[model samples]
Target: MTNKAVLYRMVMDDHLCPYGLKSKDLLEREGYEVEDHHLTRRDEVDAFKAEHGVETTPQTFIDGRRIGGYDDLRAYFDKRVQDEDDTSYQPVIAIFSVAALMALSISWAAIGDLLTLRAFEWFVAISMCFLAVQKLQDLESFSTMFLNYDLLARRWVPYGKVYPFGEAAAGILMLSGSLVWLSAPIALFIGTVGAVSVFKAVYVDKRELKCACVGGNSNVPLGFVSLTENLMMMAMGIWMPIRQFVL
Candidate 1:
């Protein structure tokens, strides 16, 4: 008995299928002797597809049995099929989680008891600062992407450049528990603008875009997560003013 696999993939001059390369690599990595077959011409590819009764390219066969495409090959090896352009919530989750924990720890150490509301406020403040830092890291890239859907940034270009600084300032002021008058209004205005922009872009206009919240390089989708950040800021903005004036 021979441990052999056959890979039928397209390798045309203008079009080379990535899945085919991945399939070939996977077979080689798994210690199989791969018999490589290339469908270089359009007619050859079309004929192969029609003959195999398959819709897509990069078809694999092992031990005289069909193994399908790249995704199917992964399933054969019990590996997770990765989506290359998929957006993730990991960055947001990590930042918010760390911010919340830090806030809780600080509140506990300072007051000798867990001040839930105060900790929540700190979480929002810290999260804003962390997000602002990400934006500030690559201001030009962040601002360019931000202008795509942000109402203020689209209308007034300088607002995109100033946003990160304003966000950081408000977050720091809130964290210090002072200058509530300045921080509150700034937080409220930005938050409201952000929420509205996200809503219109994602829901109303149905535009699929990346969020500039985490950074310019982030692959986070511009939707629920972005809106949540804005809502948190708005809530904190309202809460801070009331806490300062009333209690």
Candidate 2:
């Protein structure tokens, strides 16, 4: 016997329900023949909701049993459901993984090697840019989180706001191998301050807190990953000047 499911979702002229699409896709993927229903008009949606006594759209019914929405369907299949407030390293892991892949691709294209010194440099530089972008997404939130442990930001509130911009500028300059004079100092200063701050917060003070490395809203812990970010910045800051002037 073939498995079958039914789904009711919003598909209006102005807006389509994303969860509805996801529900349909999931059912199809799970070998279920879906009877899809679109509630296009507001009144139709309201009427359906009233009839079903449901508070939301994109509801699913499997094997003649109500399976709720996307989350519920996932739960029914024993899949992990994401909670926004949950602490996770997923974001950081994704960023670093992508950055490493990009660095390798660039190195292969430019130097005909996948594992060159240039690739390593680019990996760190790209990672910095990615992290900076995260912080820049919501400066207010980033600054607020940053002030929690950053020594300089605590004393100078504006420093927290300015940090993402500085990190971005330094990363870009380092990646392009341009204006060593400016990039090195910016990286060095921020990296030093960051390393010290993270060390004090996580180690010296033994305070447990979220890392603002990825962003203010990040759930990444304030320890190894955060310290590594600062250390990488410091290494790049020092290496760039020496590589340009010395080697």
Candidate RMSDs in Å, in order, are 7.6, 1.8
Q: Candidate 2: where are CA atoms >4 Å away?
A: none
lDDT of 2 by residue, 132-233 (tens): 999999999999999999999999999999999999999999889999999999999999999999999999999989989888889888898899999999
Clashing pairs in 1: none
lDDT of 1 by residue, 1-247 (tens): 5578999999999999999999999999988889999999999999999999999989999989999999999999999876868888889999999998999998898777676788888889999999999999999999999999999988899999999999999999999989999999999999999999999999999999999999888899999999999998998889998999998
lDDT of 1: 0.93
Query: Can you tell me which runs of candidate 1 are displaced by over 4 Å?
Result: 1-77, 81-84
Query: How good is model 2 by TM-score?
Result: 0.91
Steric clashes per prediction:
0, 0
TM-scores, all models, native as reference: 0.69, 0.91
